[model samples]
Target: MRYVTTAGVIALALGLSACGAGGNDSAAANGSPFGDCIITGEAGSSPLNLISDGVVTVKADLPSPGWYNGDTVESIKSGFDYCLLANIAHRGGAKGLNLQNSSFDGLVAGKAGSFDMALNQITITPERESVMDFSDPYYESTAGVLVKKGSTLTQSDLADSHLGVKQGTVGQMLVDKTIKPAKAPAVFPGDAEQQAAVAAGRIDAGIQDLSIVLGASVQSGGKLTVVGQIPTHESYGVMMPKGSANVVAVNKMLKEMKDDGTLDKLNSTYLTEAYGVDPTTIPVWSF
Candidate 1:
């Protein structure tokens, strides 16, 4: 339902038109299926049609720290996901970014409408594939148990603790399929609510991504801590509309980033440097 075209395409596989909208010769030479760059923008030419010509539409939950950063949606500036998208557009010859605000449940449910892609630490699963598309895995993650500092969650309450989880996340998946705690877990709209529940003693612990829990713990100034990690061993990927034409291009860009070590550098910059928590020290909590 949204417009999609290669960025900076000057001619339809020929050359720049008077209006300067077409295809990239290099892309055509490289056997790009889109034929040519049929658009023009501040960036160069590419071969894929995106949600918008000359711009990439990236769907995300505003204020997704560690993944993407902003005091608010309007203030987003830098983070792991932001840098990844910038490089993806740079490689594809797109020069613009339109960050669409949406919910995590919407993203996983394939209902976050009209964006080229979504990247909020999403994990790929076979069930989700029925309704959406996913690029090759870009990053790996595990679930962590967040508890108030000095809470007796691990020592004596493993089976009876009332857990809290962010809706539509691997944390919820773990609760439903693995943890099987004595009581039904409280599902929150987002991590902030889950963290609040834990802070208020409303839930014994909150389960979320290790990196996410670490960020929340640090921000809490020792009021919260990661008590243990669940070895979900999940890999995160970019989510797209089912059978989108952009999948090939997106995967190609991810492969290039992985091969060139750009992904690792981004991880270091945002995850390690920005969050400042090491996964190695976190104790593993087995089922």
Candidate 2:
């Protein structure tokens, strides 16, 4: 896991703590029952704890099933997840939010009937929209490939190469639907396996989120380099069951966060500040 250092976390925490409640109509001002922000559901319907304190306690799913925090077991921290946490903290302070770890299969299978939110870069699509309520996109992503530094791979030649991607990720979708590799692409179970394959010379390149791949590249000790961004227009959203009670409140908070520049600050703190990758520097390609 290419995670942020302890200093990064501390700095981010302090920065958020210093944020002033600015939006004209905050979640609290909207008369939301859940909290000053969104309400996932009524008491017991979701992980949100209904209490007199008016704080929202939510159980959010991990990036994938069985995934745990790399930095702390008591927390579900990741570069991507950290962005979400930072935004929430900036908007209403951490006191109003409580996050619990869960899995992809659990959320999708309804195993986490009590969980309130599932984020982990979950893309918002019309198909998923039919069964789930999604907040306005918290993050937008583009696919990217990681290759051995100095390697001569390019987007145009990807179709003839053996690319690696996680089995059920959008990277896999990009490879299958767009890149359309000449040879069957090497499918790994997760980022670790796919990254390992790239490092071990088992695969020519690995495809995944540009931000993720860039983080991996920086942590690769010069063994890997990001190829560039693939323009797939992927937007990641926070999800809840269909007709989630908190959708309105959540969307309200999200909109305020966007308008207040909290989202951009979070993006910089986690992605660029921690990983040192300038997203704009990466070239973008269209399928």
Report the C-alpha displacement of residue 49, candidate 1, in angstroms: 1.1
lDDT tens per residue, model 2, 157-266? 77888999865567887898888888999877556667878888899999876655766776667888877778777677777777666666567666766666655554
- Candidate 2 TM-score, true structure as reference: 0.70
* Regions of model 2 farther than 4 Å from truth: 1-70, 75-98, 103-113
lDDT by residue (1-287, candidate 1, tens digit) is 11111110000110000121111111224343222212212233335577678777777766566555545554455666776776777667765567767777777898877877777778788878889999988877677788999897773476688999888888899888988888999998877788888888899999887777777887788889888877786677888899888788878777766776677666556665544555666677888
lDDT of 1 at 237: 85
Model 1 residue 124 lDDT score: 80
Clashes of each: 13, 3
Candidate 1, residue 78: CA error in Å? 1.2
